[model samples]
Target: MERIVVVGAGQAAGWAVSTLRQEGFTGEIHVVSDENQIFYERPPLSKQVLSKEATYDSLNLFSPEQIDAFSIHLHKPDRATQIDRVSQQVTLESGKVLAYDKLLIATGSRARVPANTWKDIPNVVTLRDVQDCERLAKRLDTAQSVAIVGGGWIGLEIAATARKQGKTVDVFEYAERLCAR
Candidate 1:
């Protein structure tokens, strides 16, 4: 009757849960995520989703029914602020602590904003999760030009989307070549 706690509902967390279930681990599975949305793929955030060719519904890792069938507990829109090794529990921002026999941390990274001045701009955004994607998509609807600070996978994908939408694109990369880092 062990309880497995997974922090971050990214691909790794989803994989961990599915693997446990596939292996016939009849234990309690709990997932904690800061995002309000459920487990979904991240790659599309830059490509199809940004271009309006695909939606989050199409990128869902598992449906609500599927999650329910697995009997997995989802605690979302809340972050795990601390992990107590001695107590074997995860403390969430909601002040709820979940005791666990095993734990997994798969929280993904966030986009870094090199220029602080861009934050003040209404249209300037960092593409990260679903929310950011949606905001950028909306902003792009009436945008005539787009300035991408980086030339990484996400940045390039966004630039492609912008070009497809007939918007002018300017990419700024610190590296000599695109996606060098």
Candidate 2:
């Protein structure tokens, strides 16, 4: 049996696995992700999740049952540390090595952390994972105004959500206009 290893269990990886199954590539599918949660969407994190309009559970792209039905080995709380192309193997942070006939690297972008100068400031927080959303949501309840740093889609989403919550919002964009990216 052919073995296929997928690094990263985000939306892209989820879609890829479904497409492969649809295309009749019935090989072993092993998905490795850093997060413990199942395949989930990120777009809602900035808006619905933070605004308390939607729960984080609603973001799941694939349920545990669907993943199990597909015979996908989901490895969580682990990151791919190295890929030995010559050996056709991937080494994970947990010291687990997987051999694969085909590999897909769908590792998405990491949340950019603020500069060290902003570290000491308690008001400066980043929105990325579920915990961040929970923390920010609580903070928004007590905040009167907010200054968002980016003008991109995520930043815009956050600003809009904050405004909906009745908080004064000021967006700071390095670009001349909004939605630069």
Candidate 3:
């Protein structure tokens, strides 16, 4: 039987799997993700999860039952290092080669943290995924004052979550205004 490989287990990858099943593709389906955990919504990482109002469970895109029903094979805590176009194979970080008749790459972008600065700081955090949300949420819970380096949506959202928890928030934006133009 042929196999379909979907890279990056974010929202797009999750949707791709669902769409494939809904479209009547019966081939073996495989999802590759660098994250060890299962797929979850990213938006919640900055808002609900960071606010401590929601847990990782609340942001899950699909349950184990749903995944089993679709017969989707999940390869996680691993990354696709290279792709062999001629052979249609994906080489994972662990040197495992996944043969696929079709492939989908949905790896999303990451939060850009400036180098030579706050990134090395122990308390500095970025809200991009569930793990990030969990770490920052824990820090915010005991923080009396919070300083957000950016004024983008995620930063503002974090600010709001922090304030909701009764912590003072200071947002630093390089641009004249917050958010993207």
Give the higher-TM-score candidate: 1 or 2: 1
Identify the candidate with maximal lDDT.
Answer: 1
Give a tens-digit lDDT track for model 1, residues 4-83.
99999987787788888889999999999999886789999899988878988898898888777778888988999999
Query: How does each model score on lDDT?
Result: 0.90, 0.88, 0.86
Per-residue lDDT over 1-181 for candidate 3, one digit per residue giving the tens place of the 0 to 100 score: 8799999998898888888899998899989999977667898788877766788887888887887888888888899999998999999998899999999998988888777686889999887877787789789878999999889888999999889889999998999888965
Query: Against the hidden true structure, what lDDT does model 2 obtain?
Result: 0.88
Local lDDT at 174 for model 1: 91
Give the TM-score comparing model 3 with the true structure, all chains together.
Answer: 0.91
Model 1 stretches with alpha carbons more than 4 Å out:
115-121
Q: What TM-score fits each model?
A: 0.93, 0.89, 0.91
Question: For all candidates, what are the clash counts?
Answer: 0, 0, 0
lDDT of 2 at 63: 74
Q: Which pairs clash inside model 2?
A: none
Candidate 2 residue lDDT tens string, 6-74: 999888999999888888988899999988775789889999888878998899987777777778887
RMSD of each: 1.5, 2.0, 1.7
